[model samples]
Target: MGVMYRPPNSGQDQGHKMHHKIESACQKGKVTVIMGDFNMQVDWVNNAASGPKEREFIECLQEGVLEQLVMEPTREQAILDLVLCNEPDLIKDLKVREHFGGSDHNVVEFNLQFERKKVESDVKVLQLNKGNYRGMREELMKIDWEQSLVGKTVEQQWQEFLGVIEDTVQRFIPKKRKVIRGEIRQPWLTKEVGECIKAKEKAYNVAKSSGKSEDWEGYKNKPRITKREIRKERINYEGRLASNIRNDSKSFFKYIKNKREAKVDIGPLQNDAGNLVMGDQEIAEELNKYFASVFTVENMSNMPTIQESQGAESNMVAITKEKVLEKLRGLKIGKSLL
Candidate 1:
């Protein structure tokens, strides 16, 4: 199903008509994929706080057992364009690309993987912090490194060192095999916001059952306030993170990259002769040749070698438990590095 030009001021009557069509289609029980410019935010996070059009759409989808796959915004900080499926479990790698040209909608892409035919792929997983690092260090301290190497040949010593390390690692850092699944969720979502959403849902139910003017008013006003609170919570959470960028630059940049999905890899390059260089080898050769021609060195015959300072002292400090704890405290809980 495709929708377009659903204006912002579209009345509830028009929304109902659209919802009826979708609901009718869903009642057929065929695998349904609804996509295009919805021009509506479904408010999936705070289920009850959606606008009238979105509310109707959500209700229709819920009745049809449909789930929206695209979470990120498709327009200016709003998920206007949507990709919804009745069987979300069958959908894999659902992604929303940046908007194309001047269109307000983004390019939505996904893969269909049948659950019945899904081949289980083994994944090696290990949690580094799950191991007793102190115990491992203590065990290593008991070993006589000098004596272990003294009477052995170079190859024998290498093999012995490798064996000891491998044994220790296997004993401490155990690996588990598991099957890959779906995408992970954002960490900043809070229980407080969730409770507020539930309250809004309750209010909506009260209004629907009672059908009183005051009850409807309360329902309308409560969700608006709850949405505002949710926005404020999100802003404050991100504000605190903005302050940590300088200290934890690696994590900060990683967070930005994930949020924006900003990995760029322009494959293949065309040379000046208009011949396309396809592979890495050909591309590298072309780049090297271009650079060699453009680069210049004055008085190359009398170039002098630069020497490093002999008196430089390293300012390296030992990583203590306190330092590690402080670092952990600085990072937001549940936030992943990737």
Candidate 2:
């Protein structure tokens, strides 16, 4: 059975979960040959060779216990294709083959031999920190540690300060981990690449339109069809037409080549802030200002308001084990902290 587009919803965590499920199924006396376009690369490969997203996928596969068969030299050349087997020794001779399907991906073939054994259940439990210490350190460092609070009570300022620390640290925490098993049977294309292709097509159309208009305007009042003249005209027109077509084809392929080169640099593109948040820097600056604003107190007495609004409420609310667990799961799954 072929499965496709197994969602990487849990990111690395999902990879782990999928790994467990595959192992479980195989251990039950089933000779499982999991094959598909995983849409991921292995972590042992560099990001430049695998791309960041592919690298993350590779990390997931490693965490989940799946091994990659092909090792493409670069991420651009990296194949989304894969074939995995519970019985590796049986299909050690398998190799990739070319097909005439006109598809971007080539067909893969492998053989497998299965031998049942008493499978031992291994539970690898990892303990992770509940709080983001690096985030907490960064947030604490942002505070005006030497700022004086003349009017506010010590309790108020303390509360406000604590709130800032907690909020900043929480922002760095991961939210979920998911396990995904399957293949990308369909081609995995990014929007950026798609848009680039469209742009190239548009450019080609524009060139074609310009050429037609120029030809028509140049020969608008030419003589009506005469046997010899028509033949000559036909020859001239055909030559120009073929030239334009060649140029258009060249232009189109050039566009694609440029787009592919641009795609090779997509590692930094994944970290783009605009893609993740609206007005990223502005929002970050605004948040910093908001936190800074609360810390300022004209008098010691004024600190209570900041404290009450920020600190007191924070203290009243508690993060339960379920919430922490959820966060751990999220982190495992590849959720990013903003």
Candidate of highest lDDT: 1
lDDT (0-100) at residue 227 of candidate 1? 72
Q: Candidate 2's residue-wise lDDT over 179-289, tens digit each?
A: 344864212233444554344444434433575766444322222222234455546644554566534555444434644644432121212244433365555655665
Instruction: Give the alpha carbon lDDT tens digit for every residue of 126-213 in model 1.
Output: 7676887888999999999998899888769988999999899888887777756698755556887878777776775676578698
Candidate 1 weakest ten by summed lDDT: 97-106
Which residue runs does candidate 1 get wrong by more than 4 Å?
Answer: 1-32, 35-116, 123-183, 302-338
lDDT of each: 0.74, 0.51
lDDT for position 74 in model 2: 20
Pairs in clash, predicted candidate 1 = none
How many angstroms is residue 208 displaced in model 2 relative to the true structure, after the best TM-score fit? 35
